[model samples]
Target: MLIDMSVTPLSADDRQRYARHLALAEIGEAGQQRLAASSALIIGAGGLGSPAALYLAAAGVGRIGLVDYDSVEASNLQRQVLFTHDDIGAGKAEVARARLLALNPRLAVDAHAVRLGPSNALDIFRRYDVVLDGTDRLAVRYLVNDACVLAGKPLVSCAIHRFEGQAMTYIPGRGPCYRCLHPLAGDALVPSCAEAGVLGVLPGVMGTLQATEAMKVLLGVGEPLLGRLLVYDALAMSFQQFSFQRRANCAVCGDNPTITRLEDDGEATMIEEWTPEELAQQLEGARAGSLLLVDVREPHEWAAGRVPGSVHIPLGTLAARATEIPPDRTPVFICAVGGRSMAACRYFAGGGRPAINLAGGVTGWSAVHGPLPRPEGCQS
Candidate 1:
């Protein structure tokens, strides 16, 4: 995905603004012009997008597109540094576009305030030379990767969870795409930052790396993360690289690719859910005994705090200890957030038993009702 480096003469303001970039021999005048000519489409305006978008805009990526459907939630401020408290309730993409334009007025910022689905992914992707996938949603991650492959655009993909972050690059005919690494779309059961919690600086680090990779690919100078997974641990302050080859049977970028066109990647099996407010009312009523709250978080998380009357059953051992869950009572699954509990619901559904997920999990309950009451008892 070589950007057409038709040298665009930089204006006086551009040269003065990118004076530091002009000093680098690798970048100098030509690379700065290349960046000014290149375009990048960022597929999320959350934590990763915040830093990536800011850097690209400051570095003079002439054209930038932001695609995000979510609005600013108070939770986003912890990592999504693109917005301030004043920007809450506003569309993320729109806010990001405004911030980028403020950083570099020369940038052509396109704010697509919509979800990137299969129907429009290719169309939007065709307009950019490089794609940056900063989305935490697994299904959307795969979609972005596949769309880049199909649209013949290079993609810089990065994700952060807790204190750890991972980044990789995929170029058409260059190396493996994301699907080659995680082959199953159903693997969306993995916890996101919302469920697992992340260090505030984690995305800042990874997103900056993503921006760097996109610039490298755009400049066609340094080695992009192609064919390699770069993993960073903020806690340990360590970086590790794992090399992977393009899988021969990859459904998208393989020798005989099955995915001829972009289609929505089926998410994990949907399960019955109970909102925090709904579950709270149920617990206060006579139905409390008839419904059981099963906490599926780890032992450490269990010790932190738990809903009153909830029974602890760590997710890893749920299968082996299924008998402990009374069949007479309808089991309601819970975790730190809702992700692991959803997996628990899926497990029960597979065995022909009806189960309910605690939407947003214990965190949601705490958020709605202040804090969880002390657990009555711990059951394993």
Candidate 2:
């Protein structure tokens, strides 16, 4: 369906502001009008949602609904570019709504300072034309997918870890749902942002991609990421696309669907709970030669201030270099904060290796051992 860009009815001010868009053959007046008529719901306000929200607002998306229950923190300032230090302790959705409106007052921005769950997802999503999943929790991802399917909405989902990110789109009845690619299991362990440690800029790249996909879906131009996984490697500066097919046995969107109704997998909770003191003792043991410390933080982080004598194998390189780690040693994993290290611990534990997570990670290590020297090129 080719839209007539020149024929879009726009106010004088809107036409002047979106002149660049009007110049594009792919997205002219008709595409801009389509954007003006669409509504989208973004399900998180962290890293991914930050960029996605900013772009959607700037692109003149008619109505945007933001759903988040978190408050801004100092740590979030590193990647959530939409907020400032002053916004800390403020509700992310509310603050984001204010910032987005400031960028484009003509756009309608709705802020819902509540957590999205099975009970509320369908109703919230039904009001929008597209749904974007920017959440980091697994249970929420599943809930968003199910809700989108139930509402017959297209879902644009993205996830980031360290320097890697992945995104896919789920269009009900037209393409595979998230469950088709990742079949859920009772014992399957899902990594949380608090336990996976994502790079600050990683989400920016992936989130922008998601925004691009959403724009394409809205304008009905270009191919959406349906049935395809877009993987990004920031360190190597590479992008890889993999194709997937709908699973007939998918429990949710399958032919004989088992999950016809939305159900909660329980409330969302941060993974890995350990105090600073407990984490210190674990690191001390590793330094005492009784245990091996595997610093899963990036190479630069290891050089900054790692446990006295720890092996530096970045988490992204783990799968390929797993053989380098001796199976005989009891591994104690560490990362910038604690997220990535805990994920590393789980990965090793599942592989039959006795692995322990260093709570609070290098951040906690620095508090106990004094501030260590920053590596040459390592950014704080």
Candidate 3:
């Protein structure tokens, strides 16, 4: 993933603007020149992209492409620093370009205000030296990985969920790919930041790490995070590293690669079928008022501001007492946050029962409705 170096030297103002970068022994004049030649395509203009794009632009990556069709919302401002309150309701890609150019007008910023699909991925990818995956969805993660593999480019991937963040760089033939780590994940649609709440500052940490890795890869300066998976727990203030290797049978990068291109027919399982906003919308509608609110948590948990009329059925006893559940009422399963409730929903839904997981569960519910009221005699 070597960028074509620019023969054109930095202007006087450019040198002044990047004096700190020029002062660095490792990333001085030569490294800055290489950065000015490199191109990076960031595939999501949200959490991870916000910081990464800013750093790349500030560092003077010649061409920065942002691909996203989503519009900015008030919710995005929690972690998407590139967008201010004024930028809300504007297209994320276009708005990101404006912010980046404002930071470094010399660099070229391409805004693809269109969805990243199989049809256009390879064509767009070929124009960049490296691809950064800022997207949170598993299916798209797979698509981006495969696209990078085919287009012969390196991918820096970072993801944040709840209090945890993970990052790894996938250099073609250099180390294990994303598929080598999680084979079955591509066939599923994991919850987005919208459904699963993230700590406001978590992506900021991970995205900066991604920017660091991207710079390292482009500059060939230090050891890149190619084979090592870095994990950060913000709550615990801890970072852990694990080693992984390329699989011999990886579907895209294997000896006899099976997947030549992206296919459209695969069924992706939704990690969260219902979000808090969606549930509220459904409740406001006609039919779901009779829906059963099943609280699948421990007694102590249920005593702590559980949904008022939810049927109490602890997860451990759910299987034994499955028959006791009223079949007529469509069950809206819930737990502390979302993990346990989604598991319960999947189990019940597998049996052909009408079951939906309360995304973010009670924590999500409490965010909207405040502290939920406990059952009449359950707690003071």
Candidate 4:
């Protein structure tokens, strides 16, 4: 990407616009110019991508691409700072593209309002100087990393779960790819932001780091996070680093690779929760008699309210007290909304219990059928 440095001659307006960057001795005019010439692709224009795209565009990254097939939901406004309330129901990629261009008219923004899959990942990745993994899904993480490896593009990946987040860079042979760092399908077991919840500002912190790393990779400035993980704990207000190495058998980046081409991992596909109405209908059927309604929310939540006839067994203790759930009755896991219960469902399904996830959980249940009456032994 050295060509980015001399892609275009800086005009007088460019000097005025990037005066701050020009003032930085390290990233003076030439580096800023390189930034103005470089291109980046940010997968998933939500959470991490929100801040990264804004900062990168603000920093004058010359060309930018956004890939996301999702539409803006009202719930997205909490953290996906890229879209406003008015933008809800709009395509995320299109809205993000318009916003980014509005933020920096000089740079060009490409909106791929489509999902990134095996067919398009490599083609799109090949055009960018670097790829930023802002997507939340683990399967996509593997897809992005593998595509980057095959395309020989540098990758900057970040993820936020609840109040904590982590980031790393994969520069092919320079260090471990994502698969090496997280060598297994452990992420399938991890809860998503929808399931675990997140601090509204956490992704901002992590995404900014991604933008910073992208500049470093392009400008060849400071040491990038090539062979290490940057971990951040918001509650503790601390940052930690853990080092890792490229695995000899990374499956995709290893010496004897098995994943030369991208393919869908069935386990990586997230299970869709049943609708609130659908769950209600299921609960009404005679089958509900044979179903065990187990509440997996925290004790405080359980004490506050629960679906009538539901048994309380907090998620943390469920693994240890598994036998408490009756095998005779098909277990139907429920939580505040649906995330924890979905995780529980996955866990049980993996164990061959094959339980059902109460789509919206108690909260969703209440939304569709009004507040539940507090049981005799419960306190709000």
Using TM-score as the measure, which candidate wins? Answer: 1
Between candidates 3 and 4, name the one with more favorable lDDT: 4
Model 3 lDDT on a 0 to 1 scale: 0.81
Off by over 4 Å in 4: 1-6, 190-194, 264-380
Say which candidate scores most in lDDT.
Answer: 1
Each candidate's root-mean-square deviation in Å? 5.1, 8.6, 5.7, 5.0
lDDT of each: 0.85, 0.78, 0.81, 0.82
Which residue runs of candidate 1 sit more than 4 Å off their true CA positions?
Answer: 2-7, 185-194, 267-334, 341-361, 365-380
Model 4 lDDT per residue over 239-281, tens place:
9999998889887899998777765433223333455677677
Candidate 3 lDDT tens digits, 60-105? 8889999998789787899999999999889999999999999988
lDDT of 2 by residue, 342-369 (tens): 6666566546565666766777677667
Pairs that collide, model 2: 5-29, 5-30, 195-339, 196-339
Regions of model 3 farther than 4 Å from truth: 185-195, 264-380
Select the stronger candidate by TM-score from 1 and 4: 1
Write candidate 1's Cα lDDT for 1-380 as tens digits: 65777777988988899999999999989889999889999999999999999999999998999999878979899999999999998999889999999888878999999877877999999999999999865546777888898889999999888889999999899898998988753453444434658899999999999999999998888888888999999889999999998999998889898787875333222345677899988888997888888998887677778987888998878888988988888789999777788777767765768788887788878988887666545443
**Candidate 2: misplaced stretches above 4 Å?**
1-8, 190-196, 264-380
